[model samples]
Structure formats: C-alpha cells, structure tokens
Target: MKPYNFRRNPKPLTPNDIENGKNFNEVLKAAGKPPLITPSALKWMGIGLSSLAVLLGLYFGLSNNTEPETSFVQPLGPVPFTSALINPEKDTLLHLSTGSTIFIPAFSVVNKDGTPSKGPVEIKYREFRNVGDILLAGIPMTFDSNEARYHFESSGMFELLAFSGDNPLMVAPGKNITVRMASLNSKDSYNQYYLDTIAKNWVPLGKDNKLFYTGDSVEVGNLKGQNLSKENWEPIKPVVLNPKAQQFRIEVDPKEFPEIAVFGETIFEVVPSEIAYDPATAELPWSDVSIERTAEKDYFLISFSGNGQTLKILARPVVSKSNYVKEMARYEELYKNYLRLEKLQAQSGPTAILEKELSRYKALENQRVADMERAAFVEGRNNTNKSVVYSVFSVQQFGIFNSDYPLKLPNARILQPVFAFENGKQIPATQYFLAEMGRNNLYTFKGGDKIQFDSEVSNLLVVLLNDGSVGLFPASEFGKIPSHAREYKFVLEKVETSELSSKKILSMFNI
Candidate 1:
C-alpha cells in the first residue's frame, strides 16, 4: 500500500519514529504543554536554568554567613608535680649572712639584801671621758628588736646606773685616772682672783701654802666616789723635830696647776703653759716617800731618806663634796614641763601644726631628762661601775595580721593526715582507698570538730581538704584562732568516677 501511495506517504514509519513519538507524548504530558525543541528555545532554557542556579548558590552562601561556626578543643592533661610546690625562694624573711650569729649575756640587778630591785636601771655605752657632759656630748644608741645581743667592734665599756631623782649614789665607782701638770702666768691683780676662785671650787692642800711658788710639786689622787654634801678628811699632825734635825719640803707652785681667770666675781677656767721642777739640793733632797700606816693614829706616815739621814712626814687624803642643788632644781622643773607637754600631746586631736609642736616639746623634754641623768655623775661624783645588771623578758618578734589572702605554695609539700567519721568515731583513712584516690599523707576535713593552729613565725599555712577545697591563713591570725565558729574543720566534695578515670588517663600519658 505504501508503494502505491509513495507520493503522499513518506516511506513507512520505522521503530525509531514510533519511539520518538512515545517520548514526545510523555514529555508533553509531564510538561502539560506541547514540547518544542529549537536552537532559540534551547538558549532561553539554558539562561533560565543559570539564573535559578545563581539564586540557589546566593541563598546558601548568605545562610552560612549568618550562622556561627563551631569548633571542638581537647581537654587539658593532669597537672605536673613540679608545678604544685611552694618555692622557698619566694619567702619574705629577714635572712642573715652565712655563719653570722648574735649572742647576748644574761643580766640582772639586786638590792643590798640580794633581792630583786624594783627600779628602772638604764644600761648605756660610756660616751665621753672625764669632766664632760655625757648626754650633750654623745648620740643615743639605737637597737633592733630581733637582735639577741649588742655587737662589739672592740671591748666597750657600758654605764649601768639607777637614778634617785637627781641624786646618784656611789654604787660601783668607776675610776678616772689623770697625770696633769701645767704652769700658769697671770697678772698680779688676777692672781688674787684666781686664788679666790680656787679656794671656792677646789680643796687646797696646805694651811699656809695657799699661795704656791713656781716650782712646787703637787700630788692628787682618788677624786671620784665623793659625797655631794660635805668634805670628809683625816687631818695630818705637824711633824716635830730636834734642833739638829734637817728640814725638807715638797713645795708646789700655784702657777704650775690648773688656773682660773676672773672678771668681777665670775671665774673661768684657763689653760696653762709648760711646767718646770726645781732641782733637788743636798739640804732639801726630793726623796720618794714610803707610805706607812700607823695603828697609833688615824693618819698615814710618809718616810724618806735625805742627806744620809732618815726622815718622815705626815699626810692625809681629803674627800670633798660638790653642791648641785641649783642644777637639781632646774632638772625637776624640766621634768614637770616634759610631763605637761606629754599630757597635752595625748589630749590634743591629730593636727599637723599641733603634732609639730608636740614633737618639739618632746625633744626638748628628752634632752632635759638626758642632761639631768648626766649631771648626776658630775654633782655627786658617783661612778657607774658598781651597778648590777637585770634580766628583761620581752617579745622577741612581732606578729603579722591576716587579710592578705590567696597564698600559693610553689615548692613546699605540706601534707596533713586525713580522718573520717565511722560509727560516730574519728578514724584514719585506709591505705587501699588512699592509693585508689591517688593521695598522700594529707589531713582532710570532714564536717565536725574544731581545729587550732599556732604559728611560731611568719609563715603561710595552706590547707587542702578531701572535697577538693582549699583554705589559707596568715601566721598572725593563727594564734588568735578559735577565731572562727567551731574552731576550724575541713569540708570537701567527692569527684566523679569518670573524671577520676580521665585524670588517670592524663596522668599516665603525662609520665
């Protein structure tokens, strides 16, 4: 039939044509429209698909930008043993040099009856030599509270004495040694003034020899330890001799001694020039006198040999007293002023100007007290050698206060014993559980009971309880403890088994 209708019919439809037709119908049904395929139609379809892809890409990119990124980090391992100790290098202690040590001797004072004396006995270093005011001439000695004993650069002398008002009793009279000889040159009229000054202040040796010659020899000894009121002397009897007896005299020139210058009644000390001794003659030989004590009389006998003959002379030592009544009255007045100023200072409120005035008054008062103490020696000739020492028991160190917190122990390993309550009784932790928990001999707190701590020195006290809690206290507060309620007890919380396991793994890896 197709051959007969070749003109109208295209060669008979093949299997490919039928399959194409089925595909065309399926595409048309799915699209709900007639399916058309052309070069222009393909270009429009590709452009639509590109726009949709770009829109989808932009939507996803914007959503990603708004959302926060998440990251995962591994946990830290167990702490190292070296990082957990308290370092000694960080301690705040007053460290002394190696091999340095301080030592103080024990001292005490006693009365005449060998009982403890109830008075303040001051011990100080001797500052000046003979005749000078000690307080005015010296500096006050300063000392550290931590010092055990005073350091001695050389063998030093100390004055130990107790003041009885402004008077001083000759307890241990220290010695004052001097070998002085000088010559004085004065005007004729000034000589009488000098003599009067000497007679008023010093004790003269001879009865008729008050006006001494130029070449007189004078000897004086033991002027210290004298009374303050009266002169005590054992008079010497004049020597009586026969007509054939040779006469010899040891004369001292008044000009060859300590001199005095006077204007009206006021006298002043004058330094003198060099001295000279008159040559001894056969008639008046200068012999060394042998001092002999006699039971017949209350005086000393001096014997000598001159011109091939034996001779003797009488001698006596005088103990003179100096008057300090006026000086003592002045010191008492100064002490009253000092007390007044001190009371005023205590009563006044704190102010810079007032404080400055108080300070000035205090300094003046202290100087007056020191001067009074010094004048005691000069007024009474009371030496300090006879005084006894006394013992003083006082605090050697100062305490520290708490409130300084968060103490860290870097190198110190302080472990305490751990206790547990079982059957209402305190019991120590078992070794098995301690090993399982990875603990040492550390004390643990378990709720009840009071704890007391006494610190002997400045130190940091670290306490770690079983519940993984910690506490810190300063050395000062340790003594005042029981300061908290129920004394001090440890409280701790148990850690989870999983945490413990993780810790164990970290520890294993760490080693």
Candidate 2:
C-alpha cells in the first residue's frame, strides 16, 4: 500500500464504510420510501393511548358519587299519645333498677274483642277485690270486618245483666261485697278521653272479711292467683285503696307468676287498646319483650307523680245501644234529605255515632281512617267476631308485609320458620287442615288404622278419619280417640284448614 496522506487521503472504503457515511436523504431516494415510523412518531402514539386510559379511569371513578336531596323530615318530638314514644334508653334503665318496674310505656294496644268490651268485667286479683276487665260481659261484642276489630258494645244497661261483660270489679247484683259509695272523674291524656272511679267505706259481710283483707299480703305477682287469704280489713293496705302513693303503679316480677303468660309464656300482656287483638298474637312482630296476662284485663294502671295516676281505661262498646239513641237523635235532621235522595245516599244514624267515637277532632275528609273503622264496627257487631278479627289480622299482615322481610327468631340462630308442606308426606291430624271438607266425602279410620308418628317412623302422624272430615292427631295421643277426624266440615258450609277456628275446634267440633 502507498504511504497515506494522513489528513487529505481517505481510507480505501469497505462496503460497510460507504453505507455508514451515506446521507439519509440520498438513501431514501435510492430506496422507494423511508421505514414506516420514526422514533418520534412511536413516542406520540404511546402518549395518546396513555391519555385515553387516564380519561376512562376518571369517568369510572366519579360515577359512584351522588347529589343529596334538598330536604328531609324532622321529628316533632313525641306524637299524640305521650305513652307511645319510648326512649330506647328505657331498656337499659330497666336492667339497672330491680325494685322499680321496667315500664313498657305505651305500645300498640291491639283490642282483643269486638263488642266494645264492657267494664265491671273483672280480672280477679283475689276473691274479694276485682282488679280489671278480664272479658267484659254484655258489651255488645262483635268483629268489624271492615275495621278488623273486636268491638265491645253497650246493651242498654251498664251492668252484666242487660248485656254484661267480664266485670273488672268482681262485684255483682247481690254479692258479699257491697259498694258503700262511688265517685267518678273524667280526664284525658291525648285527644283520647278517659274515666275512672274512687270507692270509699266498702265492707265485706262474711266472717272471712278479716282474713280476706288483712294477713300477710301476697307479694305483688303472687297476689293474682288466689295466692293468699287474710282477715281484718282495717290493718291491711290494698293498692287501689292507697290514694296518696308514689307512682300509683302495680309492680310485679314475672319470675314468680309463671302460670299467667302472654304468647304461651314467652309473652303475656295482651292488652288491645285501639281496636282488636288475637289470643294467637301473643308477641308483637317488632318487639320481643315478654308479656304476661295479669287478671285478664286490658286496662293499664300507669302510675305517675302520685297515687292519682293515668288510667288507660278500656273503651266499652256502647255501639248497639248508642247507635239506637244516635239514630233517634238525628232522625229528623237527615230524614228529609233521605227522602229527597231516596235513601240511596241516606244518612244512617251510625254515621254520627262513628264521628263521635273515632273522628271527633279530625275533619271528616281526613278522618277517613276513623270513619271507616266506625262504619265497619257497626256493620260487623251484628255478624260474627270473625269479620272483626279478620280486619285486625289483615292489618297485622300488612305490617308484617311492609316490614323487613324474612322475620328472624328471638334467638338469631334459628329463623322464624313458617310451616309448609315439604315432601308428599302427611302432617299431624288437626282441625284446621280439613275444616271445610264436605261431610259426604271423607274416610273414617278404625283403631288399627291410626297412623302414629314416632321417632321410629320419623314422618307419619296419626290421623283421625270421620264423616266429611280428616284430622291430624298428634302422635303422642295415639288411638285413644274413639271417633275423631283430624279435620271437620260443618253444617252451614264446607270447612278447610284455612277456615278452622280455636273456639270451634275446642267446642263445636270436639277436637
């Protein structure tokens, strides 16, 4: 090789050398076009995709946010009945104080009977002194199908003789005890009105009077069950007689008197204040507080500042008697209108009576609730208690329906289960299951045929077969029934499980 000129002479180039030094513009001219994308172009595309991702995230992230409503309702303190509002704190307070009763305050007092329950219906705390209204006697009792209530009505006379009810005061026409004197006072707690009496110088004629009134008084709860007997009325102190007492209340502990229970010992206080209640409905759906029956009366003796306490007196049915007088009073007032309207839109006397009883304060337009109840009560009093009970049942069902679904049991572990037919297997022979079956078409079982359900069998229950009926007898009482049907079909109509009644099952059907 010749001696190279260091600065001027380039090296004799290889093919790689020529390609490396070549201008990009010249190369593009040689090739048809440049490569598809430059580095800058790729960078821009990635940036664009990143921006799109960012936008999507923002949209989804904000989607959960909501605009609140402009306004909301504020509770105006306690509602009409002061007793109804209960501070949840009362529960805690009850546990803290054992000497004083943990008052339930006011709850939904569902009426037990339809005929306006009459007073003088007694819940006997003892032989001599009557406590409260157990089952008011003559109060024209009936169910208002429309209102769904057990209505106590008046039968012209206030005492049991005319149309009596269970007397709250056990005193009667000519008994050992005599009411020497009586006084009455009318006062009300809300828009609701009330009346009560005060007795003085009452005497018992029998020799046992001393023992009946005196002696060691039974403890609060025990006094109810003919628990004690005493003599010497002067020294003994009775709850009703002590006028200037603190609370004017009856304090009883449930632990002692277990016999009188509500809802089968689970609960007992079944006082129905508004309209109607079921012996079946022992416990409230919303409340789990256990209640017990005290003297079978529906009234509550709520003690306050002194012995003069609030008496939540039971409403008696004066409907039948009152309705007659009501009509007679307003006969001429609406008769001409009835004549003009052909009685198609006549004003019956019950309208006024209803207005007086339920919708006294609320305007007629807004008093549809009270008005409807009155009309229904009047209509049903003449019929059966079934109609009245059905209405109350409907309301209870409605309450249950509107409430949170799938009611849970008192013990959270076990759910409140409704019995339903699972397998095609049979059930315990009971009256309701086949109440309305026709008398003509039914099977009668012989002694050997009794199907006993035991642990061994696990599934079968003994059934009693009878004319036009089928009964599900509990396996425990096997085969002793001479002639029985687990179910029934009565004379007036066909019976079905849906039509069974407790009274009928025990009384009419001989279940």
Q: What's the lDDT for all of these models?
A: 0.24, 0.21
Q: Per-residue lDDT tens digits of candidate 1, residues 1-511?
A: 4547446756898999887777776766866532343322222121122232353333323322311211110111111111111111111111112111111111222333444334443211121211111111111111112322111110011122222222221222221111011111111111000011111111111111011111112111111112111121222222222222222333322222101000111111110110111123324654554443322122223455544655434332221112234334433555465466556656864557646645664454445334433554454423333211111111111110000011111222222423332233333321110100111111212222222222332332233223322223323333443333342322212323224322232132121
- In angstroms, the error of model 2 at 278 is 31
lDDT, candidate 2, equals 0.21
Give the poorly placed runs of model 2, Cα more than 4 Å off: 1-85, 90-102, 105-494, 509-511
lDDT of 2 by residue, 1-511 (tens): 8778567776788999988997988878855442334322222111122232342333233222231321111110111100122221111111101111122212211123423223322111100000001011101122223333221111111111111232111222221111110001001100100111111111111111000100111111111122221110111111121122112113334333322111111111222332233332322232222222212122222211223322121211111232344434444444444355434324443344434533432332233334334654566432322221100001110000000011111111111111113243333222121111111011112222222222222111212222322333332332343333443211122234234333223232222
Q: Number of backbone collisions per candidate, in order?
A: 26, 79
Whole-model alpha-carbon lDDT for candidate 1 = 0.24
How much does each candidate deviate from the true structure in C-alpha RMSD?
Answer: 46.5, 36.5
Give me the displacement of residue 278 in model 1, in angstroms: 38
- The runs of at least 3 residues in candidate 1 whose Cα sits more than 4 Å from the true structure, single-residue gaps closed, are 1-114, 117-323, 342-417, 420-511
